[model samples]
Target: MAAPEPATATATSSPRPSMRWRVVDIVIASVLGVAGGLVFVLWNLAYNPVTAPLEAFLPGLQALFHGVWLFPGVLVALIVRKPGAALYGEIVAASASVLISGTEWGPLTLLSGLVQGLGAELVLAILLYKAWGLVPAIVAGAGAGVGMVVLDLIVWYPGAAVEFAMIYAVSGILSGAVFAGLGSWLIMRGLARTGALSRFAAGRELGSRAES
Candidate 1:
């Protein structure tokens, strides 16, 4: 099959919207970033308590929950459809989380967020920000997952067993694809339906679908 892309058709005769950031874009993007950070803060608080048993049961099962940290970048990119949206959202969210809840990694959490955001951002760039459908979301999430696991392995699982590495990697990808990718897509759909996203193309895409 061909590489995945969204079918966000625009009129050939119409001018394409500028990719430059708008004030509204920044505001909405910040809202998403803060929201994502709140989720991250909650996950951070619960992580050890939740993952201790899982790690004991299976060394890498905790990676399954890693997706909880991945969606903000993607959700921002989809909604904003602009360059750096994913990275900006991810960093803002990480900053908020650190300021509020502080992680074991301290300020290094920002670096992790940057990597994850780049993971999603790179995919969007590859597609030239033209695709925002399910496949693109999943692919972007998968990209973020890869970034997450690479950093994780380097920092947390260094000198770990091959089996652990393999499991962690696969689980991370799956988690991102589901929680970050599919999760964000579903959230966008709901937001569109509620008209909260009416100012965005994502929302317009939903409207076009319903009308058809």
Candidate 2:
């Protein structure tokens, strides 16, 4: 029998992801979106009741929930590293929430999701689709936070006090950093540890470090 050719070793040995979209990726993204949406729904349901006192006392605390919806979108973008990943995940989540529980905002919720997702998406895009460091992730979260606030203030809280608005905005940015940025980073790290994301950039970076 002819001898089989020996595999050549190179400085880098990461395999290319298949050109076609993997079922696992789609399934994971979908599941994450749905789960994130469920969280948004629950949060929204509980928000008014939970924050009513705060809203009455402070007048802008209720807007914090706006940025909560951006977490899953950022997570999906960081994991998928594909164009529209953030937008799709965010839109799916918002749509799911709206479908499950009707909102007076009507179609504007979808628009907010689109803008907020784009905010995070642009940050990842500026990173040249390469680095997924904590700084960039946090920046993406902040961007989404700012985007949501801009939309909400203009549409819903136009008459809110400047101090209230500032507090609301800051709270949203903080939430985005904690929930979307830190939380998503942790999830990615966990996924990398499990070897499930071995095909993505985040996985490769963590994998290389683990090997070393």
Candidate 3:
């Protein structure tokens, strides 16, 4: 009688890492994008009116609201943990906002979305898509904020005073870091706890915690 060879550790381990999006991944990512789009629309509607007082208080302070538009990238990237996830999520979300609710910014909004998504995407790429945590979230949010401000300066705020640009940039960074960064992390944690993300790493981590 012959005996079978023992399985190597490598052979028995999980599959190699992949950037390819599975059907489930696309579905979940699209759902997140659509939800983000709806929020973007509402935020656009309320932005001017809600920030009127702030705009009056400080010309550039209203830029604080910029973070709301940046969240989709961070949230999707963290959840999907895949290449292009941030860009795909943000662009789709932006397109949805425009198609569903319309925006005064017109098609330019799409460009903004592209750039912001790229910002977060760049961060994820830099991290090699190996980490999804508070620090990465904050960095991604801040990166999105930087992309936003650059475009704003060129497209909408050219010739603006240095003080105004600085204020706008700083406000945006802070807002993105707190509202988008921390906010998305909290939301992901909640979703993971609910097991809705069971197939994802974030969900699996929480699932393990429950068992322990």
Q: Which candidate is the best by lDDT?
A: 1
Whole-model lDDT, model 1: 0.91
Candidate 2 global TM-score? 0.80
TM-score of each: 0.91, 0.80, 0.92
Q: Which stretches of candidate 1 lie over 4 Å from their true place?
A: 1-12
RMSD of every prediction: 7.3, 4.4, 2.0
Global lDDT of each candidate: 0.91, 0.78, 0.88
The Cα error of candidate 3 at residue 66, in Å, is 1.2
Model 3: residues >4 Å from true position, as ranges?
1-7, 11-15
**The candidate that achieves the highest TM-score relative to the unseen native structure:** 3
List model 1 lDDT by residue over 1-212, tens digit each.
98755554554356776799999899999999999999998888799999899889988988898998999999999999999999998999998898888666756799999999999999999999999999999999999999999999998789989999999999898999999999999998999999898899999989999999
TM-score of 1: 0.91
Task: Write model 2 residue lDDT over 1-212, tens digit each, in one string.
Answer: 98755665643577754434466667777877888878888987777787788778876766655557789888987888766677777888888777777887749978988888887888887877666788888888887887788887888788888898898998887777777877788888898899888877678889999889
Error of 2 at 83 (Å): 2.0
- What residue runs in model 2 are displaced by over 4 Å at the alpha carbon? 1-25, 64-66, 104-106
Q: Candidate 1 at 208: error in angstroms?
A: 1.9
